[model samples]
Target chain A: MLLLQSALVQSALVQAALGALPAARPTWNLALPGQLLGALGPDLLLAGGAVLLLLVAVARPESDRHQRAVGWASLGLVGLTIVAVVAYASRGALATEGPIAVDTFRWAVDIVVLIGTGCTIALSMESNPLDGILTAESHVLVLFSAAGMLLLAAARDLILVFLGIELMSVAVYILSGLDRRSERSAEAALKYFLLGAFSTGFLLYGIALVYGATGSTNLATIGEHVARYSLMYNPMLVAGVALLLIGFSFKVAAVPFHMWAPDVYEGAPTPITAFMAAAVKVAAFAAFLRIWLDAFPTVAYQWHNAIWLLAVLTMLVGNVVALRQRNLKRMLAYSSIAHAGYLLVTVVVANSLGASAFLFYLVAYTLATMGAFAVVIALGEPGERNQEIADYAGLWTVEPWLAAAMAVFMMALLGFPIAGGMGFFAKWYVIDAAIHAPHPQTVLAVILVLASVISCGYYLGVVLTMFMKPRPANAPAVRPVPTGTFLVIYLSAFTLLLFGVLPNGFVQLAHDSVPISMVGAPARAPVASAASR
Target chain B: MYPLFYSFCFYLFGLIAIASALAFVTRRSPVAAALWLVNVLFCLAALYVMLDAPFIAAVQVLVYAGAIMVVFLFVVMLLNLGLPGELADARGLLAKILAGLAGIVLLAKIMSSRTAVPIESLMLRPDSLATVARIQGAVAPVAQPLFTEYLIAFEVTSILLLVAAVGAVLIGRRRAAAVEGVGAG
Candidate 1:
């Protein structure tokens, strides 16, 4: 009766009274859970091996000779992490309230990021000699950064997400400026570092405010609390959520926060650019999608319009600006920005359907974008010269296989019905998801189509430049494609084409990969009641 | 009488913190600016103490005022940027206007929210500081969960540190490479 009467007292007083109780202490689980370790196994292996790789570099003499070997080692690390990911994912999703999420969504994104990293490594090994950017540790930095991406993919707690973002961004800042002789590279690094730090500040502040509002850092707990309290209109939570979205927008290069992408992409080595464009975007979107779709779904109605405006503006501005770029890297940068816009559409849909569509599109986008960059690496010469659209003219005559491969990637990007192979299916699923959303983003669906149509102006421009225009007399001779770069381009084109033709199996896998948090009434009944106890 | 004294201390620290922050930013000499920033940090720590978050207050004094201020002073000395004269400020009119507007908006929001909102009815426990520092001692409450529930974050933070270290190495290695290039040429 006294305990019952205590419940009616002030909560702060109740908390203090409970703290004073001499009941058997609820023992803290200091021993890490087996499921937690299994879930984290891939990230641990990648990070631990990256440290070993750095140590190896520290021991060895600084020489260009070690670069290719280090690059291969990094590729091997990615391959191993992928194996671990698949092994764990096969056991099915682990329902975790821990900092790390172990589910199909994380496994899927991990695979995509690893594939992108592998291609980047292979391309880097091939091209670093030509560019005189043969820092042996650059490959190890890529490995560390990919490990960070894996962490980002799995992070369920806001603190883990912050650590992941920092680990990812710092390695990339160094990688961007690896070609120390180039002033452009220095400018790219400085700009990226400054802007990245700024966005991180926003993210941390958002996390702090959200923690303040919800009294929890775990995404599931936050979601549960938000729903139970009907805190969708809470000013502090609203501002925090907005800032978090803005931070993710900057990372994914959505229209307003995309100023750094073009310069960073153009100035970084092409392979690193591909990693940034493909893997970085994939990881950031994975966390963003999971965080919002899981933790902030209760407030989806509030944020839908903001994301809608972002998607609309991102799509319009990205394509319109991409249309005018003559430089191929800058063009690809804007194209990636445009792709970021399309991805934001999946976010706007805000359901398991959107999540599945996002997974499917990421796979398609990763393959084509990395392949196109590999082609760019093959075409461009030392000092990153001869990369203009005009330089790509009559590429068909010089290297028909390379030109054909480049065209496949370009058409894939454009989402042409037959020629694009997998890209059309990817776009089809996204539009389907948008139309079928709880809010039915019919207008956004239409905007997505119009944006895709605008994108054709640039994607097809590259293909036409390669096939239709006459080769300039002063066009730099296409370099002999290295074995690693060739392998990446060939495999990417082949896989994308195959999937494009028969996407049913892949689509099923993607449909299954939606984060488990979105599958039902997330986290069961009201958590506020549980918190009160 | 006690409540009045407590609030008086709060206001004293708060006003001083704001004034020192302004001074920190406006000072022409970099060393003077850095010292003023240290003063601002000390005021913040004092306010934190009044708020009953002594751990945070200690951290504020030790990390920000002690360690970080030293680093700032070192940088100011190394760059010889302490000279007040000829250090052209980049403060434009637009920037000044924006800053003033931002300060006014912040103040207005604080004042209005305090008056209008029934903040106590929000169900947020007003005394979270109790749970923050109970347990076996002052440090145990924080250290316990940090090593137990938040252990994974702690482990991941090490990777962040490693990445930072690798970045510093890359920068150093690049400088070496550049010098070698110059010598060879």
Candidate 2:
């Protein structure tokens, strides 16, 4: 009788505990191909292309002809991915489930990355052969890197972000050291790998801390938790945010963490340098904007001062250092650093207009930088000679068309008004956003202008050296321009002019692409928060 | 009486793990360090078992002490390091001091953070050992989460491994080719 009574009490306790437990969470359906494809069409396309390229590379590893063919095929695949993204954008389809997000902001960034990839492939066709990097693996690595960039831009979870970053960075590290014969290339690769791994450690630790504090890795859930719990002063969350900012600052080449940029940029293959300066920056900034705006806007006040200081220092150091650089590649590397500062200013603004401005500036910077690097590659021969600023002396006499294109790129980078270049409008948009920000960011705007004025010193210096200075008698004769390189140069220059003269269409596209739920309307909070609740 | 026994076991395993870890790091010889690390791993496995996670405990021993340590030993032997004293870091005194200072700062930061809260408070669904063992068993609780919510991460990890494998092959082949060409010349 005593044993029977004990069994009854145990049953009653079990029943009560079961009743108090939360309901079972819903499981995602991973078997549905159609829905998954609809959500991840562009990403799947890029990943498939990468795998196909890798298989082809393994099959024909020794054929230079096969490598060139793979390069062209990768370019075609990027073009197709862009078309699919545009189709999705037109349908206004968005996915907010799992670790991926498909929306206008992602599509817009995808387009930029695809265009940059296409241009890089085209530029690499002849340049890689010259630099002893013409292996089939080089083309395959580019495709994989592009896929990683797409994933980086579309990720909504911290784990996915880290994976995407590693995928992209590992491929780029290999590409940087592709010239196995050069010690400088090996040094650049080693430096990049070490520093990149260190920053990744900081990023992963920050993610772990943020997850500990908020009990979620989903951006929307973290945002909701911060809002509901008033965790603005939470020490763990603050430290995580600071660490994340440092990691991103290193990736984007912001000042104080900008030491690796110049060396890596100068030592990498010129075409790869162009890709890193353009597509990699676009993807990193995309991730940076999404995380900060979607996850931590509620506590913006805590991070705003830190970003402001980063911007000011980045601007001062980037432009001031570029003034002293004699190597053209190093100068452009510093220029890219200064551009990151301007982009950070837009991030600080953190409004719909600011988002649009950020997109526009990335487009402008990408076009000008790609065009500029094409000129650099054309000047650099098989032995990596003629990379000095003095190498551009009397380029106008030797190669008039190339000289003209280089002049246009330099003017665009300088933001000269008479040239009506895209850089001018891009800076104008940034300044306007800063002035119209919720907080008084007028001082940032003034600093931006001052930095632009300082930038003119180097930009115009390049132009003058190319056009006005006398040609060196011993200058190596200009090689015949490859068709692929010529195409990249012309396409970049034409688009820059078109956008500069008629910025309205591109501006409209960027404005329409603003992530409404996150930035514009705050009424419809991120879908993850609602669904999780 | 049961709680006292459990606490005693926990402290015993924890102390063993800590001591083994210290020895692992301080050993001058690579082989000795690896052997000490195996001891640390075994102690951790014991701690995991005491926490009613027998699955994790098994993995802790199989993966870390078994497979990983074998690989470590193989690499140590292949390298044929000349002497223990020659293996020490050749940095200046200032660099060593700075590294030590940085490590101390990191330790202090971690200790002061909220992460140092009592382990009992960190459990999402606390239960007695008997209840945990009876309700979910060892493997089911871990398997459910690993196969479901973390499925994507698991697949991505496979891709990462594949990329690393390919990169290793490419780099190794290139070095081999360069070395052979030099010898032939």
Q: Candidate 2, TM-score vs. the true structure?
A: 0.84
DockQ in order: 0.63, 0.36
- When summed lDDT is taken over every stretch of 10 residues in candidate 1 chain A, the lowest stretch is A521-530
Backbone clashes, each candidate: 2, 0
What fraction of the true Cα-Cα contacts (under 8 Å, chains A to B) does candidate 1 also have? 0.88
Model 2 Cα lDDT, one tens digit per residue, B23-137: 8767778788889999999999998888777887899999999988987887677578535754577546798689779989998988788566668756656565435655878
* lDDT, residue A221, model 1: 89
- What is the fnat of candidate 2? 0.23
Q: Candidate 2 chain A — worst ten consecutive residues by lDDT sum?
A: A522-531
Which residue pairs show collisions in model 1? A421-A500, A422-A500
Give candidate 1 misplaced runs (Cα > 4 Å).
A1-32, A520-533, B1-27, B39-54, B66-135
